[model samples]
Target: MQQCKLPSRQKGFSLIELMVGMTIGLILVAGLALMFANSSQSGNELEKSIRQIENGRYAVELLQEEISLAGYYAEIPLHGIAYSSPAACETSALGFSLTTLPMPIMGIAASNVSEICLTDRLANSPAFVIHRLSAEGAPSNPASAALGTTYVQSSRCSADGVPFKAATAGSASAFDLKAIDCATTNPQIRRYVSRVYYLASCSECGSVSDGIPTLKMAELRGTTMVVAPLVEGIENMVLEYGFDTNADGQPDVFQTNLSTTAGADKWDNVVAVRLHLLARTIDRSADYSDSSKTYQLGAASTVSGDASGFKRRVYTSTVRIVNEAGRRETVSYKPASSP
Candidate 1:
């Protein structure tokens, strides 16, 4: 018993071995952490790219939707309306009068009209206005119409008004145009639509300089123009209008400014519009490089140097003025006279 047992033979690792193992474990953990960080960074970059693309597409689509409705006054667009040049910041009754009703679309190449409802418009970007009738059916009769809101009603009967009726008073006499069969008792109305779309240089700096560019709208709400910001990261926008010189609804020439383009001031003859939007990521990406790229936007080209760190892409859309072009689509074959 006293002899007892042999000394316990348990072997322990040396301090060097323990230190080595810990070092390897630390190295593996560090590598994994680095990998995770890179993955997270990539994910962020992808998200930014997707957001940029979405914003660009949405901006283009919104513009197209508004443009399609240009010159759309229900059944009649130019019954007796004359082509008139729109002045900057003109939103009064005189601006929307029947005499100048033919101007459904207007565009400015430079930010010359900076005093318009939108002063934050970006320089070198295009601003355009669209005039149309609301797609929704307004009050059935002028007496039931909303007070202070302008409405346009098309006359199906030639006995009433030749084309349509435009009114704001909530009285029966306001609506002179009637429905088919000269049903003066029952009249359909459409709300007036006026919208100005432009690129604004405002951002979350607290800001649009170090801030992201945004697509903004100055819409005619009641008697005043209400400005609202829409899509973000829209760096710039350029537009060209397709003019129907022969009145056949087909575009014969594309021009930049509707006011000063060659064979100019034909607002009613515009059949199509081509738009180019330059969009960018809201945040600068360290991985992106565009030093060699020069963006071509409509009639203007971007400056060659790209020192801005934000990633950018261009979006283009060509939209036909449905209400303007569709009415001119009638095919008439002229037969030889009684030969």
Candidate 2:
């Protein structure tokens, strides 16, 4: 037999207490969420800024590096080569064959220069062309390299009949030159280079409609100028040419663009080049405004970026044409080695 006894008083949390506790918890959670959201947003903005800086600086470095190699003609002299207009896809219209002197560095509107460059270049921006041969040589046997590839051969033997010859094979006869031996023999072959740098209207198909500008290049692929994208978010490019009026290898005057083809000899005299690049953030920030912003691209031009909603930056660099300018700086007159 068992006797059941129940005499205990039990109490549970009231609805008001439960509701107050939940409200406090909700308020704390809301505050934490807002803080996290703000942190994430700040981090995102910082990432955009870093990307913008990296793109601008990288673009400047690329220009400085490549443009420094502007007039490198292997064993040949930049002063000795003739100037020529570029017919982007023509091999016969190759290096310096048309002009009276060498035009190592020149800038012209992308739309006006060649169709292969850009269909929609940014504001008819000047596409600067850099003429040189590759620092690295192709296979000694030109037959072993790509058939449609362009090549340059500089004659070391004065008796070879020409300073340099540029051509593409199967035109192997064009590479017939002597290598200081004065014998009709194997010629050292170098890849010919003519790179046209410009600012394009768009970088990719997704950005084509909105037109996120990009820095691009049109280089010789066979005889045709083939366009390739280098960096995205490049809005514009400006170049100031420093020409040497005197033969002292120092820049005497600076010009934004040369006058005419008759004065293209000035291009050969380019001792130094000042480059300007405008870079933009790829995305728009809802928290930021890019209203009434102006960017200075050297002494040449000033660009307006009014309410574009995109953050922009300008990068600048000065590169001296080492092969051309460095060569003329020598004081040696070959004073008959002290007998």
Residue 292, candidate 2: C-alpha displacement in angstroms: 3.9
TM-score of each: 0.86, 0.86
* C-alpha lDDT (0 to 100) for residue 127 of candidate 2: 77
Each prediction's total of clashing residue pairs, residues at least 3 apart in sequence or on different chains, is 6, 4
Pairs that collide, model 1: 201-208, 202-207, 202-208, 203-207, 203-208, 204-207
lDDT of 2 at 223: 56
lDDT of 1 by residue, 98-210 (tens): 45563678776574765568757777777887877787544455666778777777778868645666677566577776667776544567788778888788744242255
Report the Cα lDDT for candidate 2.
0.75
Runs with alpha carbons beyond 4 Å of true place in candidate 2 = 1-8, 77-80, 88-92, 96-102, 110-116, 137-140, 171-174, 182-184, 205-210, 261-265, 330-339
Clashing residue pairs in candidate 2 are 82-101, 82-102, 83-101, 83-102
Deviation of model 2 at 290, angstroms: 2.8
**Per-residue lDDT for 141 in model 2?**
62
lDDT of 2 by residue, 1-339 (tens): 999999899999999999999999999999999999999999999999899999999999999988888877776655544656554333456645512323567767534745554545777777777777788545356666467877766777888667767667676575787877787655468777778788878876353366778888878777566778888999888888888777778877777855654453356678898888889899888856656678999885998876656888989888888877887785867667886
